[model samples]
Target: MTAPRSGSILTTYRRHKELLLLLLPSMVLLVLFNYVPMVGLVLAFKDYMASLGMVRSPWVGLENFQRLFASEDFPRALRNTATISLLRLTFGFVAPIVLALMLNEVRVSWFKRGVQTLTYLPYFLSWVILGGMFLMLLGSEGPVNWLVQAAGHSPVSFLSNGAWFIVTIILTGIWQSAGYGAVIYLAALAGIDPNLYEAAAIDGAGRWKQTRHVTLPCLAPTIVVLLILSLSNILNAGFDQIYNMFNPMVYDVGDIIDTYVLRRMVYQDFGLATAAGLFKSVIGLLLVVSANGAARRLSGGEHGIW
Candidate 1:
């Protein structure tokens, strides 16, 4: 039985040799860049030393994890990461879906395209550029503050205030990615069967009723899959955006695990940094698996990443 199974596998591969060849580079790259580096995860369990190297470094068992939990910054970073990610999941996640729905209702082609183009343009811009642009635009003496002062208000320290900084992060994050997300939802919307909408309309349903009954039901699987993916990244609080936008004033509210790990790396605390990373990976894996299981159970084994 094993010999027959092995032969069948080879036969299938031979039949799809061209397609597999096309996929070879990506598979190789994934192994090299992703799987290969996983070997370094062992550093999390060791007291890494420059002189002794990764293999020869003394084993520390759970000491690195213990120190990570004991650190003042780690707790703060963990809280901030969860807070920001949840905010993004709630508001930022919904924004794109809303935008896609609105766009789908637009009758004018040029106007809809223009809106999409303008909205998604920011996603292409690097955070370094956007961060600098935002810093200038939101500064005390900038145009935004100018308008605030003109309206009989004091200049708001958007970047310097912790609460305001969090608001800024959420708003800017939404602005940057909403268009791209909307495009994804729009593609999913296109795949929905037109007959479902027509059937609902034939039942004397209004546009809202049709959307609620037909459109939303059809979009459920896509929504479920995207929601599961979002939940899996509950620990990721947009490191690039936060790193570029954050300062000491907002550190209490904005600092996250990625940035915390970066600081550890800068200080050459390899074991602790690796431990933090391993912890995040473990949490993410558990979240994704749990989310997938819940989705399958709720959807009667029809929906989810699997």
Candidate 2:
């Protein structure tokens, strides 16, 4: 029986050999880059010393985590991360859904295509470029301020002010990401059966009613999945964007877990940095599992990433 099962497995693999070959590199890369790095998570539990190496490092248990919690900066960074993430989830998440809906309603092909192109262009550009551009444009003597002065108002300190910096981060995050997110919804929209729309119209449903009833219902699964993914990354809070755009003045509002970990690594506090990273990963995993369970329950097991 065992020999027969092994032979069947070999026959199945031979039948799908081409597809398996194509998947080989991706499997190798995933193991090398993702799984291999997971071994270093043990650094979070050790008093790591360069001379002693990872295996030889002295175990410190939860000392790093205790230090992490005791640090004055950790709480502030946690608060800021949660605040920014919620804001992004609220506004940034909705922006793409709205854009996709609007684009779906557009009659003119060229106009719809043009709008998509313009919106998606920013997503392709790095934060390094966008950050510099924003800094220059929002500077005291910059064009935005020049326009404000022209309107008989003072120049606003967008980057320097904490509240204003949070606003800037949210708005810029929406601008950079909304288009790409819209593309996802657009693909989902494209998969919806046209017959549903036609049936709705036949039943005396207007465009708005059709959208509210048919389109939205069809989109529910996609929305739920994306929401789960977004919630799981609640601690992320756009590290690259904040790191490039932030400064000393806005640290109170803009500093996040990733940035805090980065500073720790920079100062050669490897154990603490690893602990912070491990904490974040653990939280993210928990969130994903919780969100998935909740989604399944809410949707009667019809929706979720399972």
Point to the candidate with the largest TM-score. 1
Write one digit per residue (lDDT tens) for candidate 2, span 92-178: 999999999999999999999999999999999999999999999999989989998999998899999999899999999999999
What does candidate 1's lDDT look like per residue over 149-217, in tens digits?
999999999999999999989999999999999998899889988888888888999999977887788
Question: Distance from true position, residue 176, model 1, in Å?
Answer: 0.6
lDDT of 1: 0.92
All candidates' TM-scores? 0.88, 0.87
> In candidate 2, where is summed lDDT lowest over 10 consecutive residues?
1-10
TM-score of 1: 0.88
lDDT of each: 0.92, 0.92
Report the error of model 2 at residue 253, Å.
0.9
Model 1: residues >4 Å from true position, as ranges? 1-31, 296-303
